[model samples]
Target: MISRASLRFSLGRFTTAEEIDAAAAKLVAVVTHLRQNAPAFEFD
Candidate 1:
């Protein structure tokens, strides 16, 4: 059988544990990249 649903926000739907882990790794890399490229704040 197949499953499906509708939601307000669709981030994603992982079918297996491995898929979730892969997504987590990618998320970490994205966060690291964002932190590295984030704009610096300056106040006068």
Candidate 2:
């Protein structure tokens, strides 16, 4: 049976382990990019 709830509310029913891993990898890449490109903060 197919579920009608959205991904965030699927109770992990419609989500796969590979999908979670891919999402985590994407998040890490985004954070890494931001860290590498963002400027350092200066305090007066």
Candidate 3:
């Protein structure tokens, strides 16, 4: 699970567009990995 702390850390520390993009990509990867590993789990 991606915690609010992790999201805040990523967004708070990144100031440039590239940094934000990288952070977003990393977040997407985390979500994808979780989805693939736990298909039956509900996100909401």
Best by TM-score: 2
Q: Write the per-residue lDDT of candidate 3 for residues 1-44, one digit (tens) a residue.
A: 43333434634553888987897899899988876776453434
lDDT of each: 0.61, 0.62, 0.67
How close to the true structure is residue 20 of candidate 3, measured as C-alpha lDDT?
75
Clashing pairs counted in every model? 0, 0, 0
Candidate 3: global Cα-lDDT?
A: 0.67
- By summed lDDT, the worst window of 10 consecutive residues in model 1 runs over 1-10
Worst 10 residues of 3 by lDDT: 1-10
The C-alpha RMSD in Å for every predicted model, in order, reads: 12.7, 12.4, 5.1
lDDT against true structure, model 1: 0.61
Instruction: Give candidate 2's TM-score.
Output: 0.59
Alpha-carbon error at 39 in model 2, in Å?
A: 2.6
State the lDDT at 1 in candidate 3: 42
Clashing pairs in 1: none
Compared with the true structure, the alpha-carbon lDDT of candidate 2 equals 0.62
